[model samples]
Target: MHGLVNRALQEFVKDTYGADIWGEVRDQAALPFDEFESMLHYDIRLTKLTIDAASAVLHKDAASLLEDVGSWLVSNPAQESIRRLLRFGGTTFLDFLQSLEELPGRARMALPDLDMPEIVLQTDTPGRFKLEIRWALDGMGSVLLGALRGMADDYGALVVLEAEPGREGAEIVVIDLLDAQFAAGRTFELDAQMR
Candidate 1:
């Protein structure tokens, strides 16, 4: 089973990145080509898993750090429902920030020295958040924001990160690929659009 999978990976690499590099990689790794491909794939997945583990650890730490504050805010001498809303939104915002911080490091594992801007979260509704990220990339900002929306959706509500006003629309963003040097501020509103 492993051999078959490796063969498929090797074929994929050969067909994708070319055969010469694959041959050299296979020989230098000192394993059958199929096994070598499997090993490489395993290593790649392991790297991703490690980043995920690190993200989880940071998330736990962030939650723990905010737990006391959150509790106090919720259990304060204020209104009952107000306490609940503040607690829920505050905790969610902190967790989202922690997760966003881990993402840049995860991206670094794939592309070293990649510059990311400051990501801040604001909640205007229950189970909803608005993300303001100041990214410097020209054409890649919207794509990155879309990916972030997908990631946030997996955790909570639907996140829509977009530019401010008279800036960039999603439609133009999807097709325009220009290398410009300017800082862009985008707004991502997360809401219970579906869930």
Candidate 2:
């Protein structure tokens, strides 16, 4: 699987710029799935990583970027619905992963600028939680996913920031799993995607 992924990556870059750039491009594009998903819980973890990556690379100041996005998401009406929906869903942390598809994105908009490998949320939960985010892009998407780590909530008060595959992904922000409003906060984080 690792070699297959490497070849696929080489093919991804090679088809775009010819085989001559394979070595340079491969070094960047060829990320193995296991390695890629290792940092994430396979649920919204990938989404957080993607959004964080985009936020970090698109904005100049990380603090300002998160604050701005967080504020915007909090105020946005549509995002408010997302948050409410997540809250109304259920109690388990896994329940929050359901509405990811409801994320605001027009069909014409580029998607999954950063393809997320399938993730398996490792936990003691009864049913194994797994998620896969796929994207179709006509170009134009954040190039920052190279910098965000996966996110996880222990169904407690400590939200775990899964380490990224590399040092470049998003940083571990805060882990507020204990807050009863944790699910609502996840909605706020997800709101970053709307921007």
Candidate 3:
């Protein structure tokens, strides 16, 4: 796992729960480092341990916690760089979905040693898209789903998400982009900024 992910988990727990809880979780997980370096790679077991500890402490499922972490990735002012990178995909929700297909490549460019997940977007029908993720680790499917949800909110797009069982090494996520209440104005503002 990447240190960025570890760092995010730490921040999410600290910000949402409390620093004290984060400290306890860290100790329970047997993590020696107080902070994770974004470009470094850590043992995947550490992430699983942290998640399990966090789940126990917060009394929430790992999936829910990961989803909230995804939301925090975009919604938190401290994560502006990542948010800006996401926005660079395009000005609209659909555009962003399409951009997901290129994320692994883009991520590799930013951090050459990073082993990013593979993302594929399929649009067989208008206003609906299917995202397939091929991850090297287990238990990250929920995190991907959460990130998509966060992206949907970031674009101010109304969306519904469904998860389907995938073949070995992959997970399929279906997204239904619904009619937006304020998308028009936001789109215009986005376009104006692009010009």
Candidate 4:
């Protein structure tokens, strides 16, 4: 697993829950190191262990916790870069939906070491879609569900999304776009506070 991925989880815990909670989670996870080196690669088990520990410490379901992490990835002020990156996917929610397939390749191009899962998007019909997430690690679909919900808000789109069980180590996310333009979303500019 990429250290960046673990670090994101670590940061999420610290930022959302607090440093003390993170310390407790680290102790529960039995991680030797206090911090994850973002450029390094750690065993995938460490990721699972951290999630489990955090889940235990927070009294939250692993999947639900991961979903919060996913939402944090895009909605948190600290993660504005990721939000910007995803926002670049499209001018509207539907454009973003169609552009999902390009994300992994774009991520790899930006950070060669950042390997992520392939997401296959299937349109069931107008305004409905299914996302097949081929994640080697569990809970990515929950994360995606959170991210999708956040992005839906960011784009001012009303949507219904849920994570469903799939084969081992995979997740299926269903999305129903209720309205593409529910409201004017948060403002995003090409430049920082260019307005």
Top-lDDT structure, candidate number:
4
The sequence of per-residue lDDT tens digits that candidate 2 reaches over residues 3-35 is: 222232233334444655544332343323422
Per-prediction CA RMSD (Å): 18.8, 14.5, 3.1, 1.3
Off by over 4 Å in 3: 184-195
What does candidate 4's lDDT look like per residue over 53-147, in tens digits? 99999999998999999899999988898998898899999999999989899899888878588899999999999998987688888888999
Candidate 2 matches the true fold with a TM-score of 0.28
Higher-TM-score candidate among 2 and 3? 3
Q: What is the lDDT of residue 20 in candidate 3?
A: 96
Report, for all candidates in order, the number of backbone clashes: 1, 11, 0, 0
| Candidates, ranked, TM-score | 4, 3, 1, 2
Give candidate 2 regions above 4 Å deviation: 1-78, 97-120, 124-132, 137-156, 166-195
TM-score, cand. 4:
0.96
Error of model 4, residue 74, in angstroms: 0.7
Q: Supply the global lDDT for candidate 4.
A: 0.91
lDDT of 3 at 4: 86
Tens digits of per-residue lDDT for model 3, 53-122: 8888888988788778877887787876677777778777777788888888888888877768888788
Per-candidate TM equals: 0.28, 0.28, 0.87, 0.96
Scored against the true structure, residue 36 in model 3 reaches a CA lDDT of 65
How well does candidate 3 score on lDDT at residue 91? 73
Global lDDT scores for all candidate models? 0.37, 0.32, 0.79, 0.91
Better of 1 and 4 by lDDT: 4
Clashes in model 4: which pairs? none
